[model samples]
Target: MNENQSSRRRFVVSVGTAALVGLAGCGAQQGESAQTSTQQTTTQTETTTPTEAADTPTTTQKSSKSDADGPVVEMKTDNEGSYFDPKGLVVEPGTTVRFVNISGTHSTAAYHPDNDDGPLRIPDGADPWKSKLFTDTDAVFEHTFETEGVYDFYCAPHEMLGMVGRIVVGEPQGGPATESPTDIPPAAQESLPAVETIVSEQRVSGP
Candidate 1:
């Protein structure tokens, strides 16, 4: 072969090899870019899904203050007469009775065994029981009964005028109501002079 012909064939072969190498490089770059784009899309999807779930609301529950499995009783106060509206009350042991004083200048005082004034006597070894005195500025008294027996009480100032009450603490026998007689122990019962009931209005502040 001639020298110029050999040189032209060599140049053509080199140009063809160069074109194949450029094509392979471009194909590798395209495959790498496509893989990176797919990974970025997967990461974005994983991040956004949890954020959307966190924004949704979740359910919650609440509780009540009173138990539905216990017994309920109501007692009222009266001022038109010098006696408790329901002069007699019955409750089970460990029951709480709320005494709402309707008028002022009244108190529920237990009859001391010695029949004295200040403090009164409760049943032997029973939980200490005392109701706050509802005076001209105080109006409510609450007491919890924790023993089984009968309790007789009278007002400190009006015991002479027949202002008295009784509380029978225990489970009722035979589901019947027991009447409280005017004659209770520790205090003699006698019908006295009736006095007109006085209605007094007063505001009480809380501690």
Candidate 2:
């Protein structure tokens, strides 16, 4: 072979060997790091993130305020939406829930049989008491809940307009009194929001 042919052949062999060495180096690098990268990815996926706005149960009991100074559910007029303002509350047992007439006549009566309108409902062994026509403003009627249960009440006149409210008295000694709202009167049942809404969202203090 001539000198040029020999030089060209040597250059070609050198290039092929360098390429083989480069491919081997790349394989070794991938083999070393592939497992580590996979481990890192799995760790990132397994980490748990915190939630937003965790729901907390809160209960507001009746302070030392007298019947006149207590929380007043407004007796709304035709112009105003005829629903109980605040809709529900959590009060201590023996705390008297006072219903004050604001405009229209309203009644805060329980879903109990003593009212001649129930079949052992709302609360057990609890006398259902409703006020006479509360036509004047600040005209009040009150009931002290000694039992630990959910009490749903409604206005006799405007119950169809969804004029209703709920009260959770002390820490309930019982689980959900009723499985569902099937037994409750359809007008009264549909009037108020579910009592679960009050029980789950609120807790009674001092007990």
Candidate 3:
């Protein structure tokens, strides 16, 4: 073959090889870019799914200051009769107690002279409280105890039925509530918790 022809053939073969290599490099770069994009999308989905689920909220009832500080006493009625649950309770000074009526008609009245001219049972000079009759279910009455002594109260209408309760603010005190009363009925007097029991147990259930 002539020298010029051989040189031209070699040059054409070299040019074709270079073009093939360039095309292969461009195809590899495109594939790598596509893989990286897919990985990024998968990572974002995995990270965000759990975060959204963790932000969900739950429902609950609101609590009042009175409920948070003192215990709840329930007035309930059964086949036997109507009575106050936890007939006796002990609390710190300034604690507000919540009285809830579960069933039957009821009222909480302090054994003070101001209330129906009853005997003085609570601490002297302490504020008196008397609740109206509760005929419906889920009725609520609240009272704050500021005096540090024994408080004797009863269900006015049902007092004859022996529905009575006692509350000790901080300690026991010498009062009409502490002594055995001859004025009230036997059942009503008996329903009143003993001062010793209320101080020791902190809570006493109805008879």
In order of appearance, the predictions have TM-scores of: 0.41, 0.57, 0.66
Residue-wise C-alpha lDDT for candidate 2, range 1-207, written one tens digit per residue: 112211011011122222222234435354432222222111000111112222211213332335455555555665655656556777776565666666676665666554444444455544355555556566555555656777776677766666766777765445334435566557656655555666777622110
Query: Which is the better candidate, 2 or 3, if ranked by TM-score?
Result: 3
Q: Which of candidates 2 and 3 reaches a greater lDDT?
A: 3
* TM-score-superior candidate, 1 or 2: 2
**Count of backbone collisions within predicted model 1:** 0
Q: Kindly report which residue pairs in candidate 2 clash with one another.
A: none
lDDT of candidate 1 at residue 66, scale 0 to 100: 30
CA lDDT scores, all candidates in order: 0.37, 0.51, 0.67
Which candidate model has the greater lDDT, 1 or 3?
Answer: 3
Please report the candidate that would top lDDT against the real structure.
3
Encode model 3's per-residue lDDT on 10-67: one tens digit a residue.
Answer: 1111222222222344353544322222221110000001112322212112234245
Against the true structure, candidate 1 reaches a TM-score of 0.41
